[model samples]
Target: MPEPANALQRLHVHLNETRLLGSISSALYYDQNTVMPAAGAEWRGEQLALLASQIHARQSSARYAELVGEAEAELEAETKAELGPSVPTERRRNLQLVRLELERQRCLDPALVASLARAQSKGNALWQTARRHNDFPTFAPALAELIALRREQAGQLAAAEAVPRSPWEVLAQPFEPDISKTRLEELFSPLKATLPGLLEQVAAAPAQQGGLNEAAAELPEAEQESLCSELLNSWGYDPARCQRSRSAHPFSCTLGPQDFRITTRVVPGQPFSSFLATAHEWGHSLYEQGLPRSTDHYFPWPLGEATSMGVHESQSLFWECRVARGRAFAARWQPRFVAGAGGDPWGGVDGFWRALNPMRPGPTRVEADELSYGLHIVLRFELELALLEGGLPVADLPGEWNRRMVELLGLRPASDSEGCLQDIHWAEGLFGYFPSYALGHLISAQLAAAMQRQIGPIETHVAAGQERVVQQWLAAHVWPLGRAVNGEELVEQVTGERLSAAPFLSYLEAKVQQLLASAHH
Candidate 1:
């Protein structure tokens, strides 16, 4: 064991070094999604495999474990001596978080980690091809391999953790700490029961006249990209620290402490799609920017990391649904839409809002209407859970996906590309991640309700074209919290209750009523 005096220093060096390794891996992933050529896939797989092995070895090393233990023990002595505050709360947070992560990481087989990394890189490449060719068979083998590895990972973690958990539960903990499968089912069952009825109601509504709204204008892809940039700027995205680019799918990633990059695709004939993607991705960036940072060290220490993907997704959904899709926002930005869109295809703010808050469902999860978005997540979550449990075979995924879509959303995908292969989650071995998208919607609505209670209506600020007010409010309440709180804890802290679907269901009901009344008007 190292000396106590130097253990802290050694630990800091190790943590920073590991952080750099992870940053390099993140950059590689970002490039793989955005700019890496197709022919580079095999080498990229090898590169990521090497990095994953190195990262796993470093994180799970006995020496690093000793350093963390010694560092914690030293901090404990300070707490007994009434010097805890002097040590800084963030330091304690970092210690607590890193200890948990190391414990978890140490449970995994390093070779398994490397294998999963390589498989994911290869799977992503195959998935793109499969999606393009509408061929599920091309991707199923790699996806099956990834799923098998994830199940193995979950089993390893379950055996190592204090209380044993199921395979899916263990996998879910990384994305949503301490969230039980039972708890998720409890929260999700109501939405599952109600959403179908809601969909039925919307579908039966003669006023809605569902499906894609007529094009108000056909903005060129270049024009859409320009508008997306302007939109991100207006949302207070700091261009100095962020880069906007194109990708096969829209995503946001933090590559460094100061460098956050997000991607959005411009779709021809879809005037506001790119802008909405920008706002969604910008919301993600804002959360990253506002995370707790240590003045002492600058490697995105565990304490400063976003609490969970659920919490992170809530920030994005808040901007996408609660703010950007609201009436006031539509009114304030209607002119921008009309000007950029090249005509009043949407007629007015009401029209634009209707266009966004479409009642009909879609095959693509990313482009699904706000009302049906949770259903999309529900379909994926159930399938992933079943897949992990070996209840759903990979070969049968496309059939199950289409079946669930028709059952939940009143439509079936015409092909595998629009169905099972639509999302990048399964391809990346992210089995437990789908739930976070729906969790985010629930958290966003609950937080919005709480925000209304404290800071007044969100509409007033957004209508006044003062989105910074909302951003600052989030910065104060949730953004800087990082991993200091878990998903349920954060929801309870902000909303005076644990996770619930009530707020979200209520918000949807209100939206439907508003839309119906407008149609009548």
Candidate 2:
């Protein structure tokens, strides 16, 4: 084999081993969330620490660096070759992946990586316990440790190379590679400027009175599970390939090319919570299931993996916001929901729709409405950026979080569980993941617009119970590409336009307006 070919083979071997380790880590994470007892938290932290050290050792190994260097040289030579352009393109792509891994690995010391992994594992447990007791102080020290480690990691990444943008940009790259702070501000500035007024208009509009508010009264867990299964089957999820379970914070995970798992929490009075969460998670699983199988199976290569969390969020938002909250969906499923909750089915489609789109400010990010959801993200983005920049101390997070909640959403959390301890992202050391939720909303609107153009009336199809049509459209245009394209390129390819705030803003304005108009009549 040529030097480049040999390097490529070695890189692949390293990547495959890293991928296996990652898969095991993912499974362990799932276990931690779903089945592991509290007593196991310390051991889990050690296991994760060991795994992180192993992965870091493999990544930072001198042999790996040599292989990457050789691959880079081969890529340059192939770039200069004139005979077969496609070969060079493939080589350059592979080289790009290798270089990205090298840069990421080189940015953080192995000790720091191991420390972060252990901190995150322990922090998760602390967060759970703190949340259960509605106490932030109990988890504050662990959170502070995580914040310190993440800030150090950000600094390390910034020092690895001269980054053109802010340190936050470099830190955010792992979650949303190629996205700049300027771009995020451009996409979000308009929403920030316009949403308050829009929200006021909807809130002042005649209140739609008649929706069910079946507070978590006494719903059985078994019944909730059964209903979740029914909804999953209705959504075309095959039980053999996809499984569901319960977790404190619901999430979806893909174990392999074919295996996917989703979790939902059962809120006693509000059975819709679990059902809707199931739908949201199903959206994510469907995207994973629909990824192009022809490409290699391992993640981090940008072949079968997701393009970005923003794109992945779009899939879930499409199902949860666009489809589940729509008039047609509520009309078809309201009967089942009413029957399950023993509520009045007479709430009418308009009333049910308004209830679904309620614009109340909330403490929980996951339960936030479309209009106010971005505000939640903006709070975290600012806090994390400050933390990364050394402008804020982790010790001040609870106060800062409470202040931001009041400033942004005009509400304050009654307890720490509803405030600083709400999300699992920070506990897991996911510093840059919050913004993707809002970004996903924008992408979903853009993609939905494109789907409408291609498939002719989506609302009509949705109202007529033709979810398969929408699913098929997304599978064909969006899901199959996987990480074969980046988020911006995928948006452009599907929408024939660049990424912009207009599509999302327009969709939100129209939906809110329709809801308001219907409520009045």
Candidate 3:
């Protein structure tokens, strides 16, 4: 009856409406992180909690589940006579994805959902204060609460699943399905074994800094902002379509389809840090800009969204590390750097390249060089496993974090702010997110290798500022497809290589040699 409810059409309308709701929610989140006055956090928290509750209820509602089920039934029932010779492939995929999401939402507890929102809201504020004060105790309680809430959420997911799983594994599924601790250990083992020695060799090399970065410390915030804007335009981001500004931590979010916003923070006296952050966040904005969307709508349905956080991070890292930190790219932009700072601070592109790609370890992960970035992730991943599964007490995290930093990077953080509290992930209850950044580097290298094999040398295009050639290749092979497949499938489909860290490691080893040679000369 009722012509089987026009499942695809109804589902599209409902999903679009859901996307609209999500856009509004994202706007509030953007403002909270960007423009929201610090005093207004309480009101903002309430707004976020209410939105979270409403969205969860709507998504997990009986009628919504029924509609999804009916849509699935229709997919199975419809024949050539009713439909046509060809299947509605896209619609079928969308419905299938939506159905899976609906089932997941159904498993979530509304009360827990609201509590998690509240935890994030409060946790962020406390983290800001704690970081500013360099007081781990101040943020520890909130962190502990957020961790508990995440654990509870993971338990709920595990309860609904057919197979038994660890809490970390269950938590990871939301970011990357089929991700497991066992799998991650196997993948990270090589990097853990190799990076320390590499760091020692590179750091010990002559001309590590080459005195190119001295002028960078004197660059002001205003000048950096202008340079960032120039960099944005150079990357082909439309000013009207996308916006950039300052934030506590650099990030990118979409407030509307055409409204892409990215935030980069300027560290006074560390001139190039913000530039790199801008590049990193811009990569995120570009991915958002390139995702498949409804021509009339800004928010994409599930199939149009990023497949996984790892893939999203890959896109960002590709631009930030693969392109921006490349020797050719540094050569092309040397004139601009001199112009921006009013002098040739780096002396030449060779010195400029060394400054941008540090081989030494650092306290901050976001500011880490390509060679050391994966080690940062490895440290975080090991810490998370301990916190979530190894029974490590939250109160002892600062010490544990410091110990690991010394062990992994041979540099201990001066304070908890630069150590355990550096990232916003734990503040927002994002335990499974760190691994993605390392995974991203791997995917970017693998994908870059594939792109090179298919096209020409990547450096050739990037050096000439012909980024569109690289962008177009990714657009054709990666962004448009979105989450149609999982991360492994996406990598294999594009690169003809199964997911592995070897490509990323190989790429880095070559980069180290290049940096060393540049240093020597």
Candidate 4:
């Protein structure tokens, strides 16, 4: 804990302060989404724009660039003296990531950065209002403005990218580095071919197929909150390090190194939404909490960051889908739901498990079941490509969305709120982000196979209420790696197989057969 007296130390100090500024923005964002009133939207937009400009300036400044160069030179000298030449190190990787980001930041105009931030804030505010009113027209102009600003931003960053990338790909780099359109199509092709068939099979099954969706009694909101709290406490949610709140959409946010927050919304008729969302968001927080930040130097460096949104989503899905939605988990929690409702509303444990594993399609992506979730992502992915790359008009989004829904999930949304405005990603100008949700399913399934190979089945742990065992397995294998590898490499490293959709499709198929068999009993 000595004072900084070297180039590397100075770089750490600089980055630490920069992270402080960035965290301020995160805190404001959490407040805006959670508690900010409607009248505060414009001022919030201005505040966010000002911070965006400042953060952009700091990242792209010549002073910061010089410090990075000095740090690189210093690290090289230290490595050469302490070890042999040509040896790679995590510090080296950290510097490389920082340099890449610096170049991208330098390529952008500060004015554009401010404009994009303002537009994103405005777009989010407008989207909430429009969604509540089921009025797409009110939000269409904001969406158009976000798209234009983001396109311009991508155009500016394109020159700085080492390889040629499409506008959407350029925007996606921050979320999933080194991802390409060709690779996505390769990964998604199997899902596109297989999932619809699975959906059709479920549709043709006998009564009780894919669970009795309308049979469960709805738990009161207060009961849902209490149950959700119990679920988190059981899963190692420490009140000291984390907090939960209500929001328009469920999400996880990190404000400081130790300060974590998650939000969930209770759908009146959907009794398990809050409980499952809590589990999902807690998965995200656990990963963030477990990132390699044991020291002051690590938190500010790239090596301490989550590698990709896909991998992040994988962690959340591991808890939400693999564990929370698994039969063993349902058996353990069935009594709790029953007690909360003051009656056995789901008939029995098997019926409760069926409710948790509803294998049907839906209009909203967030509430879609595991069997049809990939289809939701596929729909959004295709639409994103069209909107960003194919010049799909904003006004036509609703019409095209309904068309794709019928083709993909065989259901059309009756309102814009459930259709195009269900997600908060595009409202904030987040293009090329939906694909990660599908990728998460694939990654989670593959990683679960690997976990089972090493320790035991995840279901076994859930049955004994030993989720900490599952958490430990991930902590040792996945969390520590951080940005040491991207999403695909992390999968291959852990699972000893190249990433594919076979594991996910296999899981879904087996799940379908099990649920169908349970109906007979």
Q: Could you say which candidate leads in TM-score?
A: 4
In terms of lDDT, model 2 sits at 0.80
Whose lDDT is higher: candidate 1's or candidate 2's?
Answer: 1
Candidate 1's C-alpha runs over 4 A off are 1-6, 82-87, 209-216, 296-298
The alpha-carbon RMSD values of the candidates against the true structure, listed in the order shown, are: 2.1, 2.7, 2.2, 1.7
* lDDT (10s digit) by residue, model 4, range 411-508: 99989999999999999999988888899999999999899999988899999999999999999999988888898999999899999999999998
- Candidate order by lDDT, decreasing, is 4, 1, 3, 2
Per-residue alpha-carbon lDDT of candidate 2 for residues 1-521, written as tens digits (9 for 90 to 100): 44334666666667777877887888899899999999999999999899989988888788889877876776566667854565635456556666776877887888899999999999999989989998788888888788788778877887655456567777677667688877888888888887777777766764643354535323467767887888888889887788888999999998766679999998665556787788899999899888766544345454667778889999999999899888888888767655665665436667767767776667888888888888888888888887777578777888998998888888899888889888998888788888888889999999999999888877799888789999999998999766657888889988999988899889989888787778767
lDDT (10s digit) by residue, model 1, range 143-207: 98998898888877876667778889889888998877788888888888888777778777767
Candidate 3 residues 188-305, lDDT tens each?
A: 8998898887888886775777747574536767878888888888989787898887779999998777889999898976778888888888888888888888652225467667
For all predicted structures, in order, the TM-scores are 0.96, 0.93, 0.96, 0.98
- Give per-residue lDDT, candidate 3, residue 347: 65
Residue clash pairs of candidate 4? none
Instruction: Extract clashing residue pairs from model 2.
Output: 215-269, 216-268, 216-269, 216-270, 217-269
Q: Which lDDT values do the candidates have, in the order given?
A: 0.84, 0.80, 0.83, 0.90
